[model samples]
Target: MNAGAVGSDDPGPLVLGPMLRYIGETDATVWVETSRPGVVTVHVDGREWAAPTFAVKGHHYALVVVDALEPGGAWDYAVHIDGALVWPEPDSAFPPPRIATMDRERPTRLLFGSCRTTVPHDREGHRTNGVDALRTLALALARGEEEWPDLVAFLGDQVYADDTSQAMREFIAARRDIDKPPGEEIKDYEEYAHLYQLAWGDEANRWLLSTVPSCMIFDDHDIRDDWNTSWTWHEEINRTSWWHERLMGGLSSYWVYQHIGNLSPSQLADDEIYARVLEAASGASGADRVEGSELDLTEAVFDLARRTDRHPEVYRWSYRRDLGDSRLVVVDSRAARVLEPQHRSMLDPDEMRWLDEQLSGDVEHLLIGTSLPFLLPPGLHDLEAIDEALAMGKHGRIAAQGAEKARQSIDLEHWAAFNDGFVEVFEMVMQVARGERGRAPSSVVFLSGDVHNSYVAEVVDAKARHGASSRIVQAVCSPIRNPMPRMVRVMMSSFARGLVRPMRFVAEHSKHVPEPAYPWAVTDGPWFDNCLAELTVQGRDLSIVWRGGEIRDGDDAHPVLTTVASVRLPGPSGQPPGALGWASGSSAGSVS
Candidate 1:
């Protein structure tokens, strides 16, 4: 009910997006959630591709594959529903959708952040929180002041299905009894749909999604906090009465909304479930059908979601992309986890094998995007590892129970919790860095979120004490709108620093686990401002700059971006491995 072009004589069917997605050399995917079932046409470069909307449980959506565009070409585009131009409303402030095709020569620039909570963009909302960084960045991009990133990667927590805001809770209460089962959190597909609308329904963010191509992967909050953390946690959650419907709804809606666009045209073609839907839709002339002849794919799609969630190995939520010489491997750390007690692994064996195969170093930059940081701060990493060990009966029964409670309470399930997986990935990274794999990459960068704070860390190759061939770095940006509490920030900072000696001491003395081959430290920050990160790959050097919102003139309604920190990581120059030359400033600094 955004009323986008509502007062106009020609009202549009589009409700959600002309969202640019999966941009390849000569083709791109455009998605839209419409008000009704209709034939949606994507008009670009004087050519148009049309697709009819499909309904899944009464929600109408369409994916238009626009093909045969010149590489690196930028063209303004429009959306038409049944031949009436509906997008770029007459009084629209942002520019029309400008679809840009990717070329290998162009530098790959990506803007990424996670853990955003949707709220009104008003004086009250901005007083303590300032403005949402994504909204501010969208405005700047609209004004042509900030360069458009090649794509935006929303790492996780796109919506807090478990942690609902007051507004969302109010809506839920109105719909059903909040005193009933699954009181405050989302329970089904309809609730999930409304949650997405809350998250992306804002005018600025909506328009930004219209123009910028994006990819997303989910963290725990997308389902629930500490989702699939351990066998005990999984068993407990499964015992809950409403969890089945919640999981089904979460995964089903995610596929209908977010996951569909992540697949390439070929991938879609090869997908059996999607292919069946496509075949069925086409059989009834669904593609060329008139406005009312929509295909109801509710059962098939939802059934696929149920099957996928039940057997994660049967389908992959993880994906890989090649941008110029840089290969980005987006890991699905949540659902693909192997949580069996005796054989705990961060990734199931099949998922781990797939990731290892993707880790070859022929690309100039190997970027691994995991929802959880692959390399946590050393102290934090060791503590989580020790907790995992203790929880596995390294300690007595009572102490083990305490360890389990502590692990679930503090969210101790990260890469460090699974020592086998951590060691395998670390040694794999070392092999890639030292050219033992394929051609060595200039840098192996891990892009992560979900820690609720932004920071940078570097891995020191122990083999080469003085210097190493490849730079291994971890960059984290979180909470595009949500900020950590003051107490939580102070606690996390102190705990990160305070546990170093004790964690190392225990790791060295304990025979239950092997010590890490390399150690890392927090190089830049633990800043708690709501921020988004820009990671640019230029030539052989990769750099990250965190940007946050600020109110310089106390204009609560309009916040401007200030650099939180900037680190220009040059390709390994045979210098010391952990040199990590970087620059920084406070959140209000004007530094770019």
Candidate 2:
């Protein structure tokens, strides 16, 4: 972990953050992990807001909600633990963290990517995984080389609980026997806390996170590979003795560390668990006695996690954020799934209904953020649909058994795999795009990450009749750190480039597989890279750029970002459908 001490005499109390989380017109939430239970305070513009730390298993954390600030305001903030300043460490190279409120009059710039693994930011780590693109972006932002994004959305796989690095393995070994079940993988909440520290503890990225508000959703790696992929998979995993503890740990930690901050102030106020935590901590004495007397939330958190696991409808991880004229709806595609074999769905009935309500238009743009891509490459989509058909006993019971093994083995559980859900959601999106729900936005964009590749696809009217007024597109950026293996890349390339026609033929011929409501084609990528994507929405115009880190002159410490792809989608001023302006030299291929 990075040092929190400010000087020789004072050992600071901060453990992880002063991370700027949710930001609204007038209120902002700053989250932190302190060494001891204390009242964490944020001082800004002659104003201070403090929140007492709540203990979970021995770790103390607080989310200081700073309110009554001006809309579109930018204020430099300082962190204090029990009246002693702890953040903006002495002689820090980066600028002091600032809370920047949403500016409705300005364009919204959102930076997003996924699947970053924690590793040393040295030459060896770069050689294995390429330079950390997020860190490179952090350096650029610190130097003011790039404008700060309105928000950074970590779509999924923020931490790999199953794929432990050497440091995580060593930490696990020190705590328990590695030869036991759940060996090397994170087993409980404490291990999850350490794993998150490793992921976010890097000085540069931590500073970046401290300033740029972020939102997140979980993918398979957050818990385990192919987690909740299907009912059969769930049943098989439930048979294991360690799965219960692992599930509780993953869910509880996710709730405390990630989900709570995604809420707006009003939503937080309405949350029962958040209310309980604050009520318990409210009675604690000031920082003097807080060390041992802070409210302990271990049981409460675990119980909530258990309840969420049993009945996901009781608690919602999905959330919606309105930014000026645009709306971002982040879906909990992983945990809020309906996993029954007879009727599997990517989202449960409640989540689907909520999503339906959130998809309405009237703004300049509508952004749907799902960890898994709602729209995959046409070939892969058809293949997954076919897999789902076979898995559902459409081709006979024997074939269904074999298809289940293949589904889990190859991770074929995207939207297309849940055909019923895919059709329903696609219809909803079509309604918004067609202006049936409201005034058709200039664009209805799906922002996603997964598949270890980056690409852009434009959804077109399958039948050249009754076309929609809005541009329907899928913009996917993935693997901010992780890179695909060469062989897998080759396979993905074939599926993307060569198999489209053949897959379409098979899907059309299959009796069980229903045809997609709309056809889409990749317009930009299949770029396999450890990269980040930036989407800017100004009025009706929209543009997206994908970039990756490049090491020059063996300078691994300060890698430079190089653009991988750029595309501009024309606004709604009579531009022809599918008209795209690809930036020159923006080629499609592996960046590494």
- Could you give candidate 1's per-residue lDDT for residues 118-169 as a string of tens digits? 7778787765454699998888888888988988888999999988977789
Q: Give RMSD (Å) of candidate 2 vs. truth.
A: 2.8
lDDT for model 2 comes to: 0.86
Q: How well does each candidate superpose onto the true structure, as a TM-score?
A: 0.95, 0.96
Candidate 1: C-alpha lDDT: 0.82
Return the TM-score for candidate 1, rounded to 2 decimals.
Answer: 0.95
lDDT of 2 by residue, 1-592 (tens): 1345322233358878878999888888999988788788899989999988888878888998988999999999999889988888767899999999998997999998999998888999987787788999999999999988999999999999999988899889988999999999999999998888889888899899999999999999999999999999999999998999999999889987898889888888799878766665567344333335677777878998899888989888999999897899999999889988889889899999999999998999999999999889888898899999999999899999998999999989999999889999999988887889999989889999988999889876422444677888899999899998768887778767777888889999998899986888887878888899999986788888888888889888998877888888877674666666777334223533
Best model number under lDDT: 2
- The deviation in Å at residue 190 for candidate 1 is 0.2
CA-lDDT, candidates in order = 0.82, 0.86
